[model samples]
Target: MPALPDPLPDPVAPVVPLGQDPGRAAADRLLGQELRRCREARGLTLRQVAPVIRGSVSKISRLERGESPPRPRDVRALAAFYEVDAQQMRVIERLLEHAQDAEWYEQFSDVTPGFLKRLIQLEGDAEEICVYENLVVPGILQTRAYARHMVRAVMPSAEPEEVDRVVELRAERQLRLMDGPLPRVVALLEESILHRRCGDAQVMHEQLKHLLHAGDTDKVSIRILKMSREWGVTPPYPITHLKFSNGEQSELAYVEHINGANYVTKPRALDDYRNALSNLRNAAASKDESIDLILKAQHRFGDRTAS
Candidate 1:
């Protein structure tokens, strides 16, 4: 039970690079979460952990929230204090390295909101993504026209250039669904969203066709909640759940609004979202039925275009 050096030895080079990468920042966040979990489990407060790293309480808090990248030395000191085994220490070091690397999304910083930047970081690492949409199509599944129209509709004052960048950002996110082990995606859409017109008839028609195509993917599941089926409830607004790969199997819930967004980490709140999603799934039309609905909507839009 000896104390490690307050400040671990500094490296010859800078700990953080010149560029900012949310993906790398996300790694730092994961490291911080693990550190915080360890400290709390050992019944240690931030004040006590601070001295071990020769830092302040706020630093400990920030590290835990993954607000900033952690120093390798500080991570090691924390592992020692937490009695983390040697095997996990290596993983922490690797995460620190990855935190310094640049991510593709960094290029879109101009148009990306702060909350969305963090969400993107989380999404990149998530193994499963569950989304519920009532207002519009989820960005991950949106076609280019659909995304552009939705973006412009929501932010009419946004410059055309900015609108284009936001559309590009959405397209960039879709790449994750294509790459690596495709994260299992379960999306529940309100039946009305299919009928809501974003752009012209042609745009809605293309979007619906795209939805059908996306649903065909083995990893993607799309279901629609019909208006006729009374669930005795108004389903909650858009909810996104991200499940990460870590020893603890952590999950984060994201709820977005016009003013801002909320990132929920509390177990109870997450459980509530999970249960609500379950109910919505239960009330939704079967996958085949949902596809049928999508096709019908597509044909309806096609007729509008023809007329």
Candidate 2:
């Protein structure tokens, strides 16, 4: 009935690492998604909502995309404009508080890349992680030595200190993976990865042994995809599928390449990845057979080290 006050300018927020406050980041995304859904259901556009919230179209867009921290006043204005029920309003209020909470990864923001920060955050929140790797071992399952070698290979120009920081970050992620009972992980490694040497014989041996031990855990499953002529189709790039606890925005598909990565949220694209994962699972060796394969690879590396 009355015009809302103009939205206040957002402060220049610090560059906090994405993983620093995964819970908050997740809340921001979920809240934005809910706002966007409500707007679409009302057949309203960002331009229409902007004036009611006393903000620009871009500002409204940013709010709906969760790119910026939400203002309580703006959120209240939006809720009133949308005429949401009391129950829905309560949910929004809770999300707003969670989104504004302090994060843990703030200290590492200076060293971590934005994409990596986001990935780590997603991994942290994911209820289940499905990895399809054709290159080196997935970061979550890598041993410290293996991680160091891979980091050096990927970031050759990085300073020694920076490289150590990256390795430490990877180790921290692995520790987080083991710390709680939240994320159940399934890793599919191409058979060739076993032969692809990341470092010297000792490194590869330790890495393979680590995978063997990890596979024994109830929370982790590791399978090997053997090279075969009968295998019809395979995904061209590495894919990490993350399923979260939230019902509204439950799943995310991460496709990574040499230069950057793409986060796939579209239902159709996610379905495609799901199908590819199914095919890969069918083509891959069973867990026991995969373990044997890993053991053999470890022995080969062990023999080389002993020589």
Estimate the Cα RMSD of every predicted model relative to the unseen true structure: 15.3, 15.1
Pairs that collide in candidate 2 are 20-105
lDDT of 2: 0.78
- Model 2 ranges with Cα > 4 A deviation: 1-22, 25-102, 303-307
TM-score of each: 0.67, 0.67
Q: Which runs in model 1 stand beyond 4 Å of their true positions?
A: 1-102, 303-307
lDDT per residue for candidate 1 within 177-279, as digits (tens), equals: 6455547889999999999998998889989988998899888899999989865664457888888776354786777776667776666666777777778
Residues 7-92, candidate 2: write the lDDT tens digits. Answer: 22112222234436656767888889988888888999999999987789999999888888888899989988999899988888
Collision pairs in model 1? 29-66
Model 2 Cα displacement at 216 (Å)? Answer: 0.4
